[model samples]
Target: MTTTSTDLDAEALDLLRALTGRADAVFHDGQLEAIRALVDDRRRALVVQRTGWGKSAVYFIATLLIRRRGAGPTLLVSPLLALMRDQVAAAARAGVRAAAVNSANAHEWGDVQRQIAQGQVDVLLVSPERLNNPRFRDEQMPELMRTMGMLVVDEAHCISDWGHDFRPDYRRLAELIRTLPGEIPVLATTATANERVVADVEEQLGSGTPVLTIRGSLARASLRLGVLTLPTSRERLGWLLSHLVSLPGSGIIYTLTVSAADDTARLLREAGHEVAAYSGRTDPEEREVLEQRLKTNDLKALVATSALGMGFDKPDLGFVVHLGAPSSPVAYYQQIGRAGRATDNADVLLLPGREDADIWQYFATASMPSESRAKAVLAELSGTPLSTPALEARVDLKRTPLELMLKVLDVDGAVQKVQGGWVSTGLAWRYDRERYERIAAARVAEQDSMLRYESATTCRMQLLQADLDDPAAAPCGRCDICAGVWYPTDVASEAAGRATTALDRVGVEVEPRAQWPAGADRAGVSLTGKIPPEERVESGRALARLTDLGWGTTLREVFAAGSPDAPLSRGLLDGCVRVLKEWPWAERPTAVVAMPSTSHPELVSSLAEALSSVGRLTLLPPLTATGPGSTTGRARGGANSVYRLADVWQAFEVSPSLAEALAGQSGPVLLVDDLVDSRWSLTVAGRALRRAGAPAVLPFALALVG
Candidate 1:
């Protein structure tokens, strides 16, 4: 039921009619009820709903009610210029008086300010970055605030320090809200929020403000979730190209890094697809242009980091693909949510591989420290007057960890900057100790949360929905697990499984008979230039040897010729069947999997050296396996390349019971094997170790043989 302006009581309806139109100013029943409650009862309402669920519309419609009843303008604070412009445009189309203060033009801001002063603007949208401007708060908004009836914060989750797109200036909004007039109602809206985020929003909005925690259901009935696991990053890109962006409707391809976004978009463009790249580093004007292109369907797909969507409304998105895993599930959820808003049959693809986690870990290690190191650093900095940069240099903490520590300090008011350096803002001793302990505790808790989410046994969607207080939550039947892992398989499932097995079978059966193409058998098989296999197979061999090493490694055949059809194709099963029926190496499944282990250790080391020569692969430490059941196998060659796990057991020469005792450790076991003879064997061993109580097992395939 819609409660248009005409539905109000005679007095209110008459006033609304007089101010606007004669008829049909209806509002959604749900929206109107919430609006009335917010205005009459004075609540800090957080309207949590998915995109295209009319969350903003509800708040805007309520603005009219408040305007009819009160004497001030509604101030909408956002952090995206594109969103501000869109909102202003939306208001104009709806025949509402709205203006935005943004960077589209310096001249426009002056006109907006003038409109605010004249009490003619019903809605005002400004970026939070604008709030930092003195003229906005001190001169412009002061007049509007006196006449402001309500404060609406859109995409309010951005204010949360824990939010994926946290803006530091949002912290100042509380003071801005307080400066407004006459018990002004505060309305906040967001498409996504976890429990911690909700609490942060409440805290930011000021205390004792009644918050309407409306957690909409997580199920997007139109969205189909799929997962694709590729053996290499190059293979992953190929999969994305043929599956995700090939579709007709507007889509978003999310990559983990800026370089990935650039490369992915470049590849798509090369393939003659209309695509654009967006990341944090993208210029504001360029970002706006790309976003507008996406909205209008002028661009078919956008390869971007998570910085593209946020408050910008692009409801026509047909699908979203994560070309790589994001830093956290929070980020993944936010990025994927950009799709499937108003469209039917929207698809989301999560490209799977352990490499994603490894990349994330590398970034994590670069920014964060080991638990003991974090503790040591915090303790060293405890009660010490040091600026963030000074502390970073002292403790060797990277930017992210340093920023996180500073935020924690600011939140607790434990440290303050006085001129150049930092100083304890409180009674230095107890405060410093407590803040240090608290930050440590929070860090531990966060780590636990990350682990829990990573290895959660429940339905992923339910777990995500449960993080929010979505009361009507159930398994999203579209997710990987719900669609198969925890439920009976459908025809699609049987077909997909058979397709995978067939592809594997074909690769193994034909690989031996099939020869490497042209000069592919050599050290460096180049479409452009030739180089020695020894130099090309291994890192640091010498780029001078192979000037044009096509973006493929010579050491392994993980993605060999005639790979399965692209991820989205239903015909992959048929394609696999055809390959199995014809390919020469179709009979060599074990050899196909074993090919990487066959490459000489020097080759790998050389490759590693070559990459490192230019600085790529960083070898950490080689963990050796020692157990009663461990035996020494012959090295594939003179180098430390081909020693086997079974061989390691023979060398240890202990009984199975003793081996179990030693290998069944409670923490992560980094098993050193000269060669991973079979991924299947490693899989079995890993499962055994895990079942025997090892938390996790990391297999390091070292090449000891030349």
Candidate 2:
């Protein structure tokens, strides 16, 4: 029986009351319409509303209403663990039973499965990556699909390759959507999609049926936006240190790199602010704790990367600050949307950095797979399954790129993951070169738009809105340009000094390799299993990491392509001296030796000679490359440990004079190099020195690549 509009209105009122715990609660402009489309019309719809616009409420309310009519469970494909937690809590308030199956809750899978089979679960949330799990894909997914009443895709922008933060796993949704019954309602939602992305997503969801696209204005009246172009990283850090306390309430400070996030959090703590760092490397349980702390106003801020981007909820968060600009305005808009959600007059600030472009380039190239590498991986897979490590041995690609390529191939139907590992499916897959090229071009364009945003004379908010193709965008009268700067421009001298000191601190510990990589023996190296502790060099020191806030800027200039070889600067020499002065070794080094440098011989020689002169130690002849491949120039960083070991093993030879000098040394020997990347060079070089009768070897370098 068809329900009357008055009856639907009454039911919506009840859902709103149950969700917000207020009898007078009401829907926003289009919230009730969206809920009715899903619950009454059973239509596939895409909602492009801003953050905190009650998107979750629409879905949860629809789930409850559908379940009341005795429909099957609603299945939601959420992108983040944090989002799942928030959605589950929201569903419970609306009296809809929701359960989640993700990586963090492995032990509860059986209970969740049983609950679903018994019709106790009204909604089930799973991550996009979980859809590719072997057991779930082959066994549980079919059952869920057979009885699913509605399907919702949160963070739907990820489904399009043209989107800024696209993931290969999300593309699997297209195939899943195609199999769904026509009557089953489907909803896709996101806050940051341009015309291009919206069209791409609509096409993916079509499956020969029309989709209801509900796009609203992208403007946020509660957010006041501004951009500060800091000339140096230390200045940016100084600004944050001096100004974070003056912000309205607890919030988030976003950084582009993990090192920057950690460094910023440490400096802020030193400044007596209660802050924590959040990133992809953070432990899952600790992330939950941190999220809870933020929700309850226990932390002043979380220095985070994009890992905390979507679905993190704190309704009254007072500010959002960016330590460096993201690659696109769409991403920046999404991040800043976290603030001013449930409150008025939240501050949004962007401290654009000079190194942002370089960081952006690194990440952009890392995401694109090389055609040769992808083909090589497919060639190696056969009837027999091979693990990632085994595949890494056969293919020269590194671990991260290999895994990402496998994900893409899996979605393309070229491979299947089984109990043992991955195997080819005998399906012919064509490389979509034109599509990839177009995506790369689009990314570049987006980056240029972000740059424009930093320098726009008009409203900053409008620029972002324009980038997202919002037709209703206009001057947001609260921006720095719309109204003159309302924030303090002066950074306290003491705060600047503190930031400089923190950035200038050197000496990062380089942990020695503990074991040979799994497939080392198969790659013509005899070594296997654990590396003997005795043969390993002690944990060493580098003057700075290539990613450090202070030295990073200077080092990038020095290491740029075609940079002339030169001796160490006085500042660098002082840094190296400080590292030596703070050394906590058991015995002072009696001798010094340099690693062979095909590219910067003069720099290496001058560094070793200078250290020897200052420490009053004998300077031994430098080591030399033994074979043709020994001096293959500089090995680019980011290769897996197995490939790095194979590239360096037997590649270096100890000079006779160096061996003689090692034999005469009574205490430890200092092994100096220009840089340490994979640490394989230090490992093999130190091993050679040890075999030459040196009692101990201590590795030191000018820089460490992160």
Candidate 3:
């Protein structure tokens, strides 16, 4: 029953025609070779091609040919939910039966399992996170692994620590692949991997088997790449406003932050453009709707963050514009690859911003947990199981970092998550200090390369390809440097004014803490349950968020470490006045009180004095910090609410004179501070004022940390 190479080639071509619905469709240079390695030779293969190079076709065709000879279902490990949906549809079009089990489709998992047991499903797709689920790992994965005909790792670059978007969950694949029988063929594919990432992935995949690496040219002839250096964020927004319509067709507008995506989308809609915002915070249903809208050309663009980066298929997407540069050239290349996939001419532009570096630094360190924090987490879980919130109360780590650390531990076989919660497995684990340090250093180097890409004199596409280690990279003749400037360099004054107005309209409602954090009593605090609506402050306002596009730059410069703490400027005073003018509170403040500030005492005192003079109200003596050391230091910012509250509970004390003075006030008192981050400071301080007989407390700040 052995099939000859010539027969296999003819069958693959026929399947490709069915997959693409084009009679003349032919495999790209390396696509057929990759498929042959997996199907005919039964060898491990890794395919690195550009976005539009038909990587999925290789796996789909191989799955069909293998199944025709009566092999088990193909197990595809995809990254995103949107990707699963698109892949399921594509499989159906090619006469393949595919089923997916993920968080979004939880209700259908039982049915999917039944289908797999009945031998009805030809391929099964899953997210990497599912591999660690206790029930599936114990009950289903063993059988699936034994019976799987082939293994596919889509978006394979995530498996390497050297990759820009490395996920700890992906590391689990190494163990899974190691356990597979030698006869099972395997395939890994990615469009964005450099020499380092490729080497790492190949080594992980091969383990002891030899892996054939097939890489094609990374150049996209239809894409026209360019970079526009804008001096300020406002100018970048202005450029989008003035020239977005001039771009070829519907595409994506990427931003480095979620707030920027939202703000940019709002501005674009106000200017009469059909656009919507997409981010991780978006609702699942809404995200699906937005993807469809963009696909059907119902919307001109989607202002998005990296959440929309991979596996989003729009064959004719017209352009990609960035409000701020990504941290690395690899990520930049992948994002821009979304465009010109199936079109003759598409635009790719980068509007570099000054704040891009700060954003990059924040994300770089956010993923790497400190050794002390990791030990604390392990120690807390040494005996008993605890939910995420319970663990957060016991450890000083925030929710995001704590979860990330737990995933790392889970993948390393040091912990297990069960029905009750997460528990330590009593396994000895070592903190790889050298590895994390190397990762941090690599991140800094990548940031430097991105800067070079912005300022490079040669073709922009060539710079990106060179960073990705594409050996055949050459100057693309369609780029700005080679073909002259294709995009406008000027922003109209009217459009600039409109962008200013949009970014300047700043008033984010500070939600009052409703319920007490779990395990509050463990920190020696007796408070529990709701904060009693009466004691809680109403929705308050800040002059601007430190992450806002308008005043963020100025606020960052003013609040940077070692910067001089000067008196309130006229502009700040004016902004405060405007905030007050728009206040929707039922009662205005008759008195003002300042939070204890050990860092910016001058700034807080000046702001309080200026408000007192402007409002003709009495300025109470400021509260004092009673703790020995600086409790409000920056290191405490990322602690949980319970820990943050405990740190500031005994730190602030209102003098008896000030308390007595507050007892005489008739209306609400304004509680002012230089900045508001955790809101625990304002919560505890507001409780003190309420206990002192003020009718209500209103929290106000010059800036808020988003």
> Which scores better on TM-score, 1 or 3?
3
RMSD of 3: 1.3
Which residue pairs clash within candidate 3?
none
lDDT score for candidate 3 against the true structure: 0.88
C-alpha lDDT of residue 550 in model 2: 82
Ranked by TM-score, top first:
3, 2, 1
lDDT of 1 by residue, 100-167 (tens): 87666668787777777777888988876566454565677667766777888987887775565435
Give all TM-scores, in the order shown.
Answer: 0.58, 0.98, 0.98
| Native-to-model Cα distance after best TM-score fit, residue 365 in candidate 3, in Å | 0.7
lDDT of 3 by residue, 1-706 (tens): 6889889999999999999999999988988888888988889999999998999899999999999988899999999999999999989999999999889988988898889889999889999999888777777788798789999999999999998885999999988999899889999999999999999999999998999999988999999989999898778899999999999889999998888888899999999999999999999899999999999999999999999988999989999998899999989998998998999889999999898898887788778877888889999998879998889988887788788899999888888898778999999999988988988898889899999999988988888889999998999999999998899999999999999898777567777777777788888778899998777776677888887787777787778778987888888888887888788989989988887777778888888898988988789988777873223633475677778877777777778988899988999998888788888888877877787777898888888887
Q: Scored by CA lDDT, what does every candidate get?
A: 0.53, 0.88, 0.88
Superposition error at 582 for model 2 (Å):
1.2
Off by over 4 Å in 2: 627-634
Q: Which stretches of candidate 1 lie over 4 Å from their true place?
A: 1-29, 103-107, 178-182, 245-248, 358-460, 483-706
Error of 2 at 157 (Å): 0.4
Question: Can you list the residue pairs that collide in candidate 2?
Answer: none
